[model samples]
Target: MTSASPTRAPGPFSRFEWLVAGRYLRARRRDAFISVISALTMIGIALGVATLIVVMSVMNGFRDELLGKILGLNGHFTGFPIEEVFHDYEAVRDRLEGVDGVIAATAFVEGQALVTSQYASSGVNIRGMSIGDIEKLPLLYSSVLYGGWDDWDNLEGVAIGSRLAGQLGLGIGDPITIVTPNGPQTPFGSTPQIRSYPVNAIFDVGMVEFDSLFVYMPIRAAQVYFRLYEDRLRDGVAQPDLMASDEEIDAAYERVYTATAVEVFVADPDATARMQLPLEQATGRPMVFTDWKQRNQTFFSALQVERVVMFTILSMIVLVAAFNIISSLVMLVKDKSSDIAVLRTMGATRSSIMRIFCITGTAIGFIGTIAGFVLGVVLALNAEAIRAWVSNTLGIALFPPEVFLLSSLPSRVDPVEVSVVLVMALALSFLATLYPAWRAAQYDPVEALRYE
Candidate 1:
């Protein structure tokens, strides 16, 4: 070994290369300008990543929150008759129960009417639903904060939305009148049907659209109001019995009351599309099936488009930071030309010289990405609190339910999306190092140290 030293092993880049790379990254007072530029580059990358994470997470949160409220109130799939009321709804509902992916199937009647209290009047959508169904639905059950479900089916009882109650100056036990557009046709003219019912319950679904514009009535009451009576009655006409048996009239009433639609809830809404054909086949009737996605396509599409546009615009921040990385590395190479030349003269290869600068630049990106990730996660986790603090301090309301349709700001982070951002930042920063690193490697040792 003394006579002839064993050949040294070779690697792509050795320990010596890493040491030099780390040393160059360390801030030195003599290179104050370069050091400051390097720090700014890192800060720039960090801020960019943080902004992207926060914005993307907020958008995701908004979509999920809106979908939950809408879907919780409106089932995943609904089957409505083409034009006629579904007179054979029981048979249809029974058939639907056999369909795959059907969680719960029930009959529902929907209609539009003008509702008035002593204080105000407004047009609202009235849905006729069974009290048993209401009890089974967690959204409806949990929302009934004021009254119990015992009196929901009493022909004189109704459930109104909290916002609707407030607007009409009505509360539990207050009398509210519903007037439907259709009524019994008389010889002179048609008159709208009016019925007064006490507000048995108040529900708040936390959605402005539903809260301000919907009310619920017993299915039997809705049938009478909408005039879904037996075919024995003449067109939009009601006949009182003079000598006919009450049992015959009651049997006729039972035969006619039917649902306008059948609402179907599924275990997984995303897979509801697969249930469409099966459900239609099971119904064996000409029916229209509308999924939640189809019903709210425009709104969801707009949200997705806005999210993409915001991401593209914000990614420019990271791109700008990448350019800063390029500038700093270029300056660093120029400042250390003599040192690189010295290493080259001492048997260091050109590739090793390139790797040194690459490591230095990537370190900045790596550390910056980690810092931004942590900061963003923390901020998103405490978004509501931060929103409240900012709102209180600024004397303003950031999310007024009446205006924005949501009670507060929402934020949700997807780990996959976060990982993508991290990888993107690192990739951009690594690419930024290439040109400067190659230039440093190509310098002539003699020229670099000619006048040193």
Candidate 2:
């Protein structure tokens, strides 16, 4: 049996240490300034943590909203003809759909056109899609503010964006003329096709760009208006007159068709690159394939860089609070020097003295961090509502749809990020206590009491 060392220290964080730590933290007339400093330190920490959480959550929300709107409307991947226009799109669509992980394939004819209403005119990109494929994009069909998908195909009319309709002073059933340079080639030059189609539906996607610059029409009408597919008599055959009989109109339906592009959707958009090879094999043609990430690389890259920068800048708040902790602990140690000496003379170990100050300082940080965490979560969860309330009271558009892509503010609180912040704050607080606690533990009882 080994003999116990006579100078063995008491168990760590003993009851005595906690009692002394509590006593020192309590407000006293002599230590009023120290208490004030400690209070300010805790407040600084709370404010810093709360601000970081709110900013990070808002940035995350912005990124997610933008990504979802862009990708939701434009699919995960798209391919266009490199050599020739996408011919036999039906068969190509089927083949592309057969690829592993491919969710759906939609063939679309997109062309730049100038849309004119009686009031105004705007340059718009017109996308033509079949009803079956149109329904696949829930972001479009589901957002129809007025009018709907009913009789959408039979009407041969068009769907215009809400903003476009508003700007042109047009409503549902109003005729909107479209002029495009993609018409038939004539002796003079490429003849511009000018035709008017009634607006049958209106959609508001809550995104300024999309809501203001897009028009949707049935696939057949788009093919006809854009001259993508046409039926005519053989060369040298007599062309039918404008008032051709119904029989002639029926016969004209027989013609070859082509599509400008095909958009593919996959199960997981983030892994879109993995589906490239399979899509190429399925197409078996020289096609230009582009994914969402590649198309928006610069935009999303900027967002990521901004997030990191914000985190670094806001972390300084917590750092400043940690510095305050050091200042406050040092002051507390000075004010309690005599008490520390008395405790030392009464059989209290140096470690106990150190722990007293450590506990006092750590307590402030722990409580502050918890308070900040709670405040952050509450604010993040209700960020949009708060924005609305403030904006209403101030009579300002906080997040205007035209300026910001999203109509309303958005926030998403990530648990992992919150956890990291708490740990970092606690670590800084603990570190700040070390030197002050060490100084308190080094008190000399004989020298300290000699002056008394």
Candidate 3:
């Protein structure tokens, strides 16, 4: 028995591991039909990945751009009362200032009026603000395309939006008549008066609607012009016949003067409700607070829905490519059945047989996914260049400046999004290999050898 000991053989890997895997890939190349199918599958995955990346990045860029436009034009939150006027505005401002998240507090008068120039007339929204308070708002400071807030401080002058100026055919230092409801005691009786203001400067915020409708002036000037404190007497009541006295006029005026409103700016745009609570308590008015999100909810919601729909549609391509992988693997199992049986007879484990096919399928997915990711990043980073190339080559604009807010294509490739996409592609590829690999591993050595 001691003399009959036999030498142990080396493992199968040392004998034929590299050769087996290399031969499988090479054999695939030699089969023209299989090679074509594999090539198509690779192309499909690449196209799918590339499209998904470009589309998602573009959507992200668009979302950022749209949000910037909205936030820049409008502040995060605006706190105002349900009533036409709020009394004790100073108290309201004090309460808001004491709040944790409030950035700034300012008082403003808002009303509708008709603006008339010698050559034209246009209806506009009159916004009255203190020049000092206006400067505190960062959006206004940054958006000052022309002129400064100082222009509003001057009593005789008003600042008009650039587009409004264009529409009215007016410029700086031009005289414009503003007709507001101002109650003045004339020789006959108290009647509504109209005042004229000189346009001192023009500002353009790059937003067409704001430019066309907004006109800013000093708060005091607006209060004086509109005569907010003037009271409307009861119908059929005569001043002398009813024996109305100065005390009554003074009391009525006091009623109007006591009403005031404060607008607070919050640090976090999303804290509108929190900021409103303090203002509502101080003013004793029903406070209505609005944020940018609520203001443009429809637009932002549409963008999100579009993104999801686009991603789902593009994912179908990857699904189709995965199916192609399944087809390739099934064909591969048939081609390798004889070799699988020979290896089994040599005591190769079923798990190793399955692993070989799994590795092959995973290699294909990995290669295609990586290639697509690289290509997508390159295209996304150079989207403007690609857009220009397409435009120049086709002699047509890919993204028309008039149609889109941005003149060129925009893209922002987020690393996290790219990582998720790559992981999904790899997972799909791995899943595609499982069934075929399992089938290959279940091959019977005797039956496979008999057929060979």
Candidate 4:
């Protein structure tokens, strides 16, 4: 009569496929001891990944912040004439602007002078720049805290940094005298002269060293105050007798006879060498050029080392969690020997047996790692909020400006870093599955069933 209905074949991963393997992992939860150990392992992986992300982001943020501050206060690159004064700075500037990666170029005179206030005095590096050109360097404009640089007219006025103003107890429109090394000559003899300049404005650059040690002045004022000019040497001759006043003569001689040096400010902060080449070649004098990175090598180097050390130390947590995975899987193998033997009798291949346990172990690691990554990124992204919350709730300051230079916590989560950490977590988890999977695969059906 009709053909017998073909028996339905069991699908891959049917009840029989998972039952033996599922029992091995479920048994862990049934035993309070195994359950605690497994939970701790997951916690360890989560904490490890979270800590690594947060710490790495913080370090990266600090590095970026520091670089910004440095580059802002100091131009990306500086070039100087090989000779004391660049006779053909216009030509040199033009040539530099034509260089590859060169953005803009400006010439400046850099010198050291004594800055004095009513109550205090400190030595500062005076930079002579054109107001129009200086404006191109946005850092200078943004850093102006108390007064505007526009006030630096052809008049004898100067812009001091915020730190310098505070240390000197000076403020906007304060009268601070700048005494630069000058020379005066008269019929009697020649002597050094000093000139005074009123503090016109103050800028807060947030960098202590630069803020405390730098002042900007109009090019002519600096040339006059420091007497850096060629008028004192008329017709290539040293004229000590051109004294209207002894003070005038000495200052003029100092300005004219002394060589003039030009400090070139470039647009591209990284092309220190490229910009320097033309200036040195054109001037026929030895000029030194330096970039922002080279200027702050020590600080950046320390930060880099700290980042590596912190990452290395924190990874131990992940390693310990991996050991937990190993221990859990090993125990599962021992407890599931009879089940593994039964599966073997049912025609489940050894490779299939291995796959089951491997999947189980990997699942544990994947869950913990994914959870940790999500939580870590969330925490990192909202670090500022977390800091604020902690401060308000606990009544404790997290990052004090006086101590940290920044008033708030900094964070910068990188996608690449997160991906690497996730992959590493999964790899460690997969590694933990090996020995146990192998042990389960080696089980002999006859021997396993003989005992039962």
- Could you give candidate 1's per-residue lDDT for residues 1-452 as a string of tens digits? 34432222366556787789899989898989998999989899999899889889988898898998888878888898877667888789888878777887878778999999889999999988888767656787788768767866775588888889899999888999999758889997888899899889898877888888988888888877887766555445456577768865554443467788887888889997788888899997889999998999999999999999998999999899999989999999999999999989988878889999999999888888888888888888888899999999999998888877877788899898888888999999999999999999998999999999
* Model 3 lDDT per residue over 314-404, tens place: 9888889988989988888887789899999987778778877887777777778888888888888888898899889999878674456
Candidate 4 has an lDDT of 0.73
Name the top lDDT candidate. Answer: 2
Which segments of model 3 are wrong by more than 4 Å? Answer: 1-23, 26-29, 87-91, 112-126, 155-215, 220-262, 271-276, 282-286, 382-412, 445-452
Off by over 4 Å in 2: 1-11, 184-186, 230-253
RMSD of each: 3.6, 3.6, 6.5, 5.2
- Report model 3's TM-score to 2 decimal places: 0.73
**Which segments of model 1 are wrong by more than 4 Å?**
1-12, 231-255
TM-score of each: 0.90, 0.91, 0.73, 0.78
Candidates ranked by TM-score? 2, 1, 4, 3
Candidate 2 lDDT tens digits, 1-452: 98644434356677777887888878999788889998999999998999989989999899889988897889788888887756778888889999889888999988999999889999999999988998889999799988888977777899988899999998988999999887778899998899999888999987888889999999878887877875646554566788999887666556777898899999988887688888988986778899998899999999999999999999999999999999999988888778889989888888878888999999999988888888988999999999999999999988788888787788999889999989999999999899999998998999888887
- Model 1, residue 176: distance off in Å is 2.0
Q: Candidate 1 or 3, higher TM-score? A: 1
lDDT of each: 0.85, 0.88, 0.73, 0.73
lDDT of 4 by residue, 342-390 (tens): 8788777888888788877877788789878988999888888998999
Candidate 3, 152: how far from true, in Å?
2.7
